[model samples]
Target: MVALKSGLKIRKLAATLLLLGSSCIALELHTDPAVAVDPVDAVCSNRMTLSVTGNLKVPYCSNKILDQPDLSVQRAVIVIHGTSRNADDYYQYMEDAAKKAGKLDGTIILAPQFLREEDIESRNPGNDVLFWTNDGWKEGDSSLSTSSNPRPAQVSSYDVVNFMMAKLANRNVFPNLQTIVIAGHSAGGQFTNRFAAGSQEPIVESTVIPMRYIVANPSSYLYMDEKRRVAGTVDKFAIPTAQEKSNCPNYNEYKYGLEKLNSYMQNIGVNKIRSQYAQRQVVYLLGEQDTDPNADSLDKDCPAMLQGKQRFERGTIFYNYLQQYYGSTIQGNHTKVTVPGVAHSGRDMFNSDQGIQQIFGSSPNHHLNHPTQPTYPTSTSNS
Candidate 1:
């Protein structure tokens, strides 16, 4: 199993996995004969929902995740789905890692379902698979329209995060709650990066609470200058350069629209949304062994063009660039570490304690619990 990166994304499922309203029953999912269920973290999986509001209905299943016959963990961890949408596998791997690291009891793991277009509220069109149903909801093109479609609807799939954040932030839900980790691998890693880069959730911003984001071996990145007009290399040029006629032949949609980008920022400002991005602590977890010669990832995607290089190369390059140009602000704040002897497997990096500590390491003298202490914008990318 591999955690995916958002920039390496494809079409997303559109339906809801669990039914809404208070009339749903919990499900008990188990292990396949192919994989051995570790005796320590062995338990069935549970179902949860993500609504537009902060309200989330968590199913209390007999899974090992919630069964605290023993106390070992002190924080709540939320595991998101990858491009394959195999969230169950992600949960299982996370459980295994937690148990191995002796942090199982302290961590509460939830895998939110973001089905494809057919799954979105059950808009199933005959044979079109329903993602929200019993799994296997591959990503799809369920939308169009610039302002109306992508902004709210496409982004809506991530609404599940809002639901989960509300719970972790609420002391009542997690009495002994002390830390929270948002993690993903590969395609899932891509999502973690974009979400961290864009998410403006206040629950994450209100405290010195370390809103740590971990990205492992994602294939792509949504470049800041994704318009394509800036060719070869971009960092050497000035900020916000005009797109020439050659690149991004049709710059409106292929490249995130200039107007749309402005609108997004404007709306946030007008709406007075608090952003943790400027100071958010993010870690790029690249697998030392993972690389694909043929894939949309590491090719012509936002990150591909953004870095002027391949996936892993760019992540490393960007990390160095930040440390170099933004050294003053990132002073001991940002970190970029590489995982050893690991390929592009989801289980590899998600289980990395060293990587986890890089973003959310706790000590008597650490202040990961502060508010959105803004840092000036800095730029760097792998070339």
Candidate 2:
């Protein structure tokens, strides 16, 4: 007979077996199996929605997060989904990693959905939901103009993060929380990088809790200057000649360089934003196998080409360029982590040994690459 753990209710069915030569007694028993459930699914069977204001319901998941009985959550991991707008999928990956590292009990996992107009149209979330223009949300821009529906208030995608952080910062909501990590890969990575630069949220300043940003394998980066890496200087930072800038004048525009700023970042001076960004904790996670110069969704614009032919190269160039621009006086607390054998993938990048350490704070040295390797941008890959 197998003894079950206390508090476990079980039912047993038994049968007797007979032998040919002699009477024999055998016991056949049926017992209920212990079913391990995912916290995300257990707590939120479906996506949970947060109303930003009157009519806009932003969908998200908080994963038992800070509401567990007798459990004090101390850290949170906010994972931003990629262009696919697959928040649910991204949440699962983060949840799995947290569970693997035994941090699931104390860590909150949040994944916010930024839907496109097409998604809104298909779902017809009524007038109560908010959706952004195609890729407008990525730039932290306001909702798109719709001919049928009068613009539903002017809320930027970044505002969603600000709103969530405000809730988390509330002492009553997450009293035990001491740290928050904002991480994203691919397009989400681009958002995390830019958001960290100009975010006006005071949550980062909360004396009680510190926040960290993880920008992983973004296709493009927002350069702080008009200068770009010369094509020939493959491994080093070399600015384009005067003639190159002359040929591509608009190359320094927004999203590429700090030239024409968007409405969200226009008022904030570039120097001010750079200064703020320099003082924060940032990690640049690059994919080592993302070297396809002509990969799908590689941002083949002339501006992106100026950075590098591939994602891995561009990330390396950008990190080095920042160090040079900021100089030695106030160097930012930025660390580079490399994910080997992955390319343009969010799941693999976040679940790797390196991802576990950086996001959940376990086995910290497992992610560090060799010192001789280009340590500026730690290489990661997605397969």
Per-candidate TM vs. native? Answer: 0.61, 0.77
lDDT of each: 0.44, 0.66
lDDT of 1: 0.44
Off by over 4 Å in 2: 1-53, 65-71, 201-206, 234-239, 328-332, 362-383
TM-score of 2: 0.77
Q: List ranges where model 1 is wrong by over 4 Å.
A: 1-45, 50-73, 118-155, 203-208, 222-245, 249-259, 262-275, 296-299, 321-328, 356-383
- Give the Cα error of residue 193 in candidate 2, in Å: 0.6
lDDT tens string, model 1, 15-81?
Answer: 1224122223211111110111111111123434333222222221212333233244456666665
Give the lDDT of residue 171 in candidate 2: 65
Q: How well is each residue in 198-268 modelled by candidate 2, as lDDT tens digits?
A: 76544232255677888999878888776677676744555567777777777777767777777666656
In model 2, state the lDDT of residue 359: 88
Per-residue lDDT, model 1, residue 215, is: 71
